[model samples]
Target: MPFYTYMLHCSDGSYYTGHTDDLEQRISQHHAGNLGGYTKSRRPVRLVWSQEFGERYEALRAERQIKGWSRAKKEALIDRRWDELSRLARSQSQFTLRQAQGERVSIVADAFEAMQSAAQTAHPREACGLLLGEGDCITAALKTRNVHPSPETHFEIDPQALIDAYRSEREGGLRVMGYFHSHPTGSPSPSETDKAMAAHDGKIWAIVADDDVMFWADDKDGFHALSYDVGSG
Candidate 1:
C-alpha cells in the first residue's frame, strides 16, 4: 500500500505518531531539514513503531487514536507488549529507572569526535552513533546512519555490530553507557521534543551537535551544556 504510519519515541520517551505515503523517504526529509515543525528542533528522533495500511484515512485514524493514549499505553505499543498494556491502563502513575551519573570530559570528547566523523561522511544530512563505555571511559564507538528521516529522523545501527561490540565489552566488564548524534544545521540544545522524548532515568546521556556539541543528562532542568573539559563526577 501507499499509506504508512509510524511512531517515534523521542529522547524524552514520549511517542509521536504520523502517516506518510513514502515511509523511508518521508523519514529522510525529517532529518534533512526538509520537514520543519515539532520534530525540526528535535532533529534526532527514533522510530520505535510503524505499520502499513492500504488507505490514508486508516493511517490518520490510527495516529489520532495513538496520540491520546497514556504514556504506559504508548510504551506498550512501542514495545509490542500488548498483555501489559491492560494492566498499565489501570495504574495512575508510572515510574522509570534513573539515568546514570554524568561522565568525564575525555569520554564526551571521544563521542563528539566519532559523531563528527559520521557527519562528515554523511554530509548534507547527519550521522549518528553510540558510545559504549564504563563509568566514564569510552571503550567502543558504534557508528550508524539515519536511514529513515521523514515525519521524523530514525536511526539504524547494525545489530550484529552492536551485539559483537557489547559482548566484547561485557566480557571485559564494561557497559553500554551513552548515545550521541549530530544535527546538520541545528544547535546542540535539546528542543521541546527532546524533553518530551527524554527518559527519566539518568542512564541515557543524549549528546546533540551542530558544529558545536552539547550534552544533557536526564534531569528536571532538562538538557544543559557540559563544559568541554570540566569533568563532572
Candidate 2:
C-alpha cells in the first residue's frame, strides 16, 4: 500500500498534519465525524496538501516533521513554496538560487488544457497532475481528481500510469519534470504550509487557473515566482 503525509486546513484556519496509508478512507472517516479529536471540533476541514512516499518510515517521518510546523509554515508546504520552506529550514542561509535559472521553461499547450478541464470537473475542490518536460519545456500533462470530500480530499497517480508516461516520454527523450495543481478557492500564490513540503532543489511547481498559470522556484526568499508563458513556446 502507498503511504501519504497530508495536511488539513481546518475550519478555524488551523492546520493538521498526519500520516495514513489509505488517504481516501481516512479522510472519509474525518468527514463523517467518525474520526474524532482535534479535527472533529474544527469540522469542515479541507485537504490543502499531500505527498507520497515509498515507505511507511518516510511518510511517518514527514508527518512528524510537518506536525511541528506553525500554521503558516504548513500552508507554505502545501503550496510547494520552496523559498519559504527553506527560510524556515535554514534561518541563516544568506545566498539563494532560483531553480529554473535560464532553463528552457514553457507550459505545454496540452497540459494547460488538461488543467482547465480538470479544474472544471472538480469544482469546489482542488485538482492535480504531473507535467512532463524536456529540459525546460513542458511536453505533456496528466490530470487527476480527489473523489473524497473535504478533510480527506486525496489525489493519486497510479505507479503504472506514471511508469507508462515515463516510458513514453523517454522514448521521445523527455522527462517527468514537475507537478501542477490548482488551489480552487485560494490564490495562485504558494502558501506557508506549501513551503514546508516543497522539494529542496531542481523541481518545478506550477499553479493553474481558469485563465492563467504561474511557476515558482525554490529560492532563499521562499517560492519566488518566475516568468512563464502558457500555451506558448
Candidate 3:
C-alpha cells in the first residue's frame, strides 16, 4: 500500500501536516472531527497539498519536514511555487548563517571575478546580472541586459532574463540568490534610487564600481553592509 504526506489549511489560517496509509479515510476523519487532536478544534479543514511515498517511513519523514517549515515556506509548497520555495529556503539558511557568523556573507571566487569582469567590460554603462547559487553562497553570475533608459547611471535587468532564471530554477537549476549591478562613476554602494526601487525581500545585493565590489542585504529594515568571504562554492 502507498503512504501519503498531507497538509491541511485550518479554519484559523494555520496549517496542519500528517502522514497516513489511507489518505481518503484520514481526511474524512479530520473533516468529521473524529480524530481529537490539533485539527479537531480547527474544523472545516481543507486539504491543500499531498504527496505519495512508497514507504510509511518516507511519508512520516515528509510530514515532519513540513511541520518544521515556516508559514511562507508552507504556502509556497501548497501553491507549487517552486522558485519562491527555493528563494525562501535560501533566505532562511542565510538568516541562520548571519546570526551564527556575525552577519558575514560568502560567494564563490569565480562568481566575484565574473561580476568584476562584466562590470569593467560595460564601463561607463552600468552592468547588471543575476546571482545564482544555493543557501548562502553565490556560485554563478549571469550578465543580463540593463534595460533602463539611461544605462550610464541606472540599470534594469531584462524582464525576460528574470523570468527565464526562475523557470530554470524550477527545473533544478541553481536558486536566484540575488543580483549584481555596477556604478561606473560612483562608489560600490546602494544609490538613493536603488533604495527607492528595491523589493526589500531579504536577498543579497552586490554593487560593483570600478574594480571594487561591496555586498549588502536588502532586508526589511533597509539595506545594510555585509562583510564577505570568497570560497569555492
Candidate 4:
C-alpha cells in the first residue's frame, strides 16, 4: 500500500503538511474539519501538493521535512520549480524569513474605523460589535449594544444582534467571521475574562485599547496575535 505526503492551503493563507496512507480520506477529513489540531479551524483547506511513497516511513520523513520549510520553498515545490527551491533554501538564513507582519488576514478600513469610533465614544465603558465578511477578511462592523452589567469593564454583545447576524449569513449575507470589543483602560490583549468567556471556536477577535487595535485568533491552545491589514475597499 502506498502512503502519501500532502500539503493543504488553509483559509488564513497558511499551509498544513501531513502524511497519510489514504490521501483521499485524509483530505476529506480536513475539508470536514474533523482532522482537528492546526487544520481544524483553518478550514476549507485545499490540497495543493502531494507525493506518494512506497512506504509510510518515507512519507512521514517527507512530511516532517516539508513542515520545516519556509512558505516560499513550499510554494516553489507546489509550482515544481526545483531550481527555485534550492535558491530559497540557501536564502533562508539571510533573507527568506517570513515577514514579521503577515498579510494573510485582512480587515477593511471602514470596519476598523467603525470599531475605533464606537470604542472612543464608549470610553470609561466597553463597546462591543460583530465582524462580518468572507473567508478571513473583515469587511464590515456591526456595532452591537453592550449588555454587561458593569459597563465600565465588562462587555457582552446584545444576544439578539448575534442571532440576527447569524440568520443573515444563512440567507447569503456577510458571514459573522468574528467579534470585537474594547479594553477601555488597557492594552488590546485578551484579559482573564476574555480567556474564560470566549468559546475558542476558531474565531478572530479584534481588541481595541486607546488608539491601537489588534487582532487575535482564539483557538483551543490560546489567543494568538495575528497580524492583519486594514484594507481600503
Candidate 5:
C-alpha cells in the first residue's frame, strides 16, 4: 500500500509532520483530537500539505526531514514560495550545492490554492491547467479541460487553451510560466509517462496527488525537485 508524509497547520500556528498509510483516516483522527501527543494540545488543526510515496520508508524519511525544518522554511512551503523555500533549504551550512539545478522556479500561494481546488474538483480523474505569472513566479492557475479519454489515468490539456494562453501572452497577459496536473491516485512525483512526455525546456511542473503538492523543474537532465512558496496573487 502507498504511504503518506503530511503536515498539519495547528491552531498554535505550529506545524506537525507525520506519516501514515491512510491519509484521510489519519487526518480525521487528528481532527477528532484523538491522536494525542503534540497535536492534541494544539487542538484544531488543518492539513497544509502532504506527499504520497509508494514506500513506507520514503514516507518516514520525508516526515523526519520535514520535522527538522525551521518554521520559516515550512511556512515557505505552506505558502508555495518555491524560490524562497529552496534558497532556505540550501542556506544551511550542512546543505550542499546538490540543490543547484532547480533554481528558476516558483509558484504564488494563490496560484497553488487554485491548483488544489482544480485537483480536488476533478478527483478520481486528472485535472490539467496552465500556470501563469510574471518572470519566474507563478501567480495564477487556469484550469482547462482534460481532453483525454482516459482522464482517470491520463491528462491532455485542451489545445485551444494552449493557443489562447500563447495568444494572451503575445497580447501582454501573464506569461504561461508552466503547467500543473493532478495524479488523482498516484504519487506527486513524475511518473514514467510524465518523464517521457517532458520537453525538458526548463518549465515548472506542479503535480498534485492526494493532499500533497510538489514542484519540479524540467530540463534535459531530467526532473529536478523545485521548492514552491505560497503568496497572495
Candidate 6:
C-alpha cells in the first residue's frame, strides 16, 4: 500500500497539509472531525489534492515541505503547474534577484527566434517549452511536448520532461528560469487560467501570440509587464 501526501481546503479559506497511509480513512476522519485538531475547528474541509508515494518517509517529507509553502505555491502544486513550481522551489534570496534586476528580463537572441519559430510552427495549436538560464537571463527555450488534451485552448508540458529537467538542475545544469507558451489566437498576455495557476514566485513567463512575444514577471501582486533585451544574455 502507498502512503499519501494530501492538502485540504478548509472552510476558513486556509489550507492544511498532511500525510497518511490510508488516504480514504484519513479523509473520512477529517470529515468526521475525529482527529480533533486543525480540521476539527475548520470543519467542512475538502480534499483538494493528493499524491501517492511508495514510502512513508517520502510522503511525510513532501508534507513537511509543502507545509512551508505560500498559498500560491501550494495551489501551483495542486494545479500541477510544473513551470511555476520549478521557480517556486528557489530560495528567498534568489527571488530577490528579480527586484535587484530592475524588473527586466534578458534573453539570448537565438532563444527568442527559436520561441517565435516554435509558435509559428505550432500554429492553430499551443506550443509550450521551458526557459532555461540563470537569474533573469534566458539562454535557451527548450521545447517540450504539450500533453494537454485540449492543446488548441491550453498547454501542459509533459510532467516527465519537467521532472527530468529538475533532476538535471539538481546535478548542476542550467537553472529553470521560467516557461513559454503560445496563445494561438489571443494576445501575448496571460489568460485567466494563467492568472489562476500562477505560483507568485519571481519567475518570468514568455507568451507568444500573433507572432509577437512578450515577457511578464510573476509577482505576488500579479503579473507585471517586463521589458526585455535580446543579446548575449
Highest lDDT against the true fold, candidate:
3
Please provide TM-scores, in order, for all candidate models, with all chains considered together: 0.44, 0.47, 0.56, 0.57, 0.60, 0.56
Worst 10 contiguous positions by lDDT, candidate 3 = 92-101
lDDT of each: 0.58, 0.65, 0.84, 0.81, 0.80, 0.81
Q: What would the per-residue lDDT of candidate 3 be over residues 1-233, giving only the tens digit for each residue?
A: 99999999887655777889999999999999999856777789999999999999898778755654666788999999999999998986785566525877777656876786677668779999999998777889999999999999899999999999999999999999899999988788899989999999998899987645778889998898786766544
Model 3 ranges with Cα > 4 A deviation = 1-101
TM-score of 2: 0.47
Model 4 earns a TM-score of 0.57
Per-residue lDDT of candidate 1, residues 1-233 (tens digit): 67987977544333456789998988887767587744555557777788898998888767655553555677887788978886775542221112233533334333443554565455556555666766655544567645544313434455665677678767885576656665655566566655686665554454444334555566566654442331111
- For model 5, give the RMSD to the true fold: 12.6
RMSD of each: 17.9, 18.1, 19.0, 15.6, 12.6, 19.1
Clashes of each: 20, 23, 0, 0, 14, 0
Ranking of models by TM-score: 5, 4, 3, 6, 2, 1
Which of 1 and 2 is ahead in lDDT? Answer: 2
On TM-score, the leading prediction is 5
Q: Which stretches of model 6 miss by more than 4 angstroms? A: 1-101
User: What stretches of model 1 exceed 4 Å from their correct place?
Assistant: 1-104, 108-111, 147-166, 204-208, 219-221, 230-233
- Candidate 1 lDDT (Cα, 0 to 1): 0.58
Worst-scoring 10-residue span by lDDT in model 2:
91-100
| Descending-lDDT candidate ranking | 3, 4, 6, 5, 2, 1
